[model samples]
Target chain A: MLYIKIADLKIRIENKYNYVRALCKDYIIDECEDYDISVSVSDKEIDDEISVAEVAVSRGYAEGVCVYRNICYQLPVKFNSYLLHSALIEYEGKGYAFAAKSGTGKSTHIAIWQRVFGDKVRIINGDKPIVRYLDGEFIAYGTPWCGKEGFAVNDSVPLRALCFIERSPTNSIERIPASDAVLRVFQQILTPRDAATLDALFPLLDKTLMQVPCYLLKCNMDDEAATVAYNGMNNDN
Target chain B: MKIKSGFVVREVAGQTIVVALGEATKIFNGMIRLNETGRIIWDMLSVGSEKADIVRRITEEYDIDEKTVQADVDAFINTLQGANILE
Candidate 1:
């Protein structure tokens, strides 16, 4: 069982499948041992718990045989697609993360910004970063969950804005009220089931919204939408 | 219970957490795991329209047998009732 803390929330990631550390169950619980992690092998199989334990490497991703509880899941020893289930990223940065339903082109719009702003911006987390409040300041951290580009960089930065993505004919970026922004981001966030941990999430979100601005970035997969999003974020008051 | 737009719905510890354009407050009790189809049913019910109107929409949209739809709808309604998240 591994204890992980974000904001004030405490979660335990227990590798219970086997020796390879291939299967993990993240629970929002103060007590770690009570949570259960189990898996039944499907087409892909790795001998036993020992193999699962061996696979739990310190700092890199791997393709392996694994399961998410009762559901049999496979992870490419090397994952390149959008980090879907296990990737968790968070940080404290100058800007908030952009979150949306899958296939919403969160990566594409981000590319537009990189092309337009170039040196003015930094790539904090490509996808599914964790955002939390530590002490009194919010922080974001990069997790194993790197989206399409498979760009995983473990770093933290100060958040400023959160942008929701959508492709629209007219390039427009509009501010979303703090209440709405918090809810949207919260939905996209990967949370476990600990009341204390869950409770911390909303408060941090509220705090982040109080200081940072959130917006809906609607535009074609063109630079104009990126421009509108940036301008809107900078202008958020 | 209350419903709102774009609420990120999550199942946490068998509890339903709704982040409805506000906070990630939750409604817990008997759980309803809204699958793709279930979510569609929930979306329809969320419109605040009459149950009969929702039934009409479901009949038009899904290929489900009417009896099955009614049963599913009733089961869903009972689940929500237990959770107190439904009107």
Candidate 2:
């Protein structure tokens, strides 16, 4: 049994699998005993303990390779948070996320940011990060199952911008309209198909979008692309 | 026809968004963004308002002619029907 904090939420997890435990080693905290949510992951057939949606997402996204990832998606909704399929990075002490389809080079774009900023930029999570509206601001946090690169830290940063990246001949960034931004952001999140859950989820999403500025970043895999994005977003607001 | 049971029209940052909820989300595909007039019509549709009632209300609210309001309402209703959002 281990207690850890992700997305500013305290959780205690009991796991029999070493792989799952190792994935969350960086997040383990010894000081906390009470948890808002507790998760147990095992191969044992515990029929009543699992959700149908959890099993569906396990097969759909992680392909059942990691039970832990499935839980990461499920638990956030209970706290009015959502897990987004994006690479979250901390730049200049603010959180910026890159979102796109699977093959849209989100990770590659992050690499370019690292190349440009070097020591100044830190990768919060390479893959999925949970986001929630907190105290009149949106915050992005790192989770254990970051991505294939396994780049994640148990940290939280105030979200500044969310960029939907696209490959293009020339580097450009534009502020998307709220309608367009809502659709794009909604598609990138792991949402449960339950009315009560969605009722809670949509308001959180709406507040996040209302607070955070979303951009459509069209760029290629080049160092110039990084500079272009940084300049454009900084000047946008 | 009535609007689907699980669809909610929410206004965020001055933009109106029609979102599908629960099992409706699986088949409703994506959300639709509407202008101020669209939001007004959606509100009426949700309450089982008919096409004639919508056209009458829009003509009364806006300075537009009855023919124009009817055309706009018809187009909007068609879009909702095409998306399979109306019952």
Please report, in order, the local distance difference test score of every candidate based on alpha carbons.
0.51, 0.78
Query: Candidate 1's residue-wise lDDT over B6-86, tens digit each?
Result: 345554332344433323235442123456556766776677656565566677788766777777777877766665556
Q: Can you list each candidate's DockQ?
A: 0.07, 0.34
Q: Going through the candidates in order, what is the number of backbone clashes in each?
A: 37, 0
Task: After superposing candidate 2 on the true structure, give the runs of residues whose Cα lies further than 4 Å from its correct spot.
Answer: A14-19, A30-33, A40-80, A133-137, A175-180, A192-207, B63-75
The number of the candidate with the highest lDDT is 2
Per-chain TM-score, chain A, candidate 2: 0.86
Q: For residues B25-46, what per-residue lDDT tens digits would candidate 2 score against the true structure?
A: 8668566788878988999999
Show model 1 residue runs off by greater than 4 Å.
A1-93, B1-87
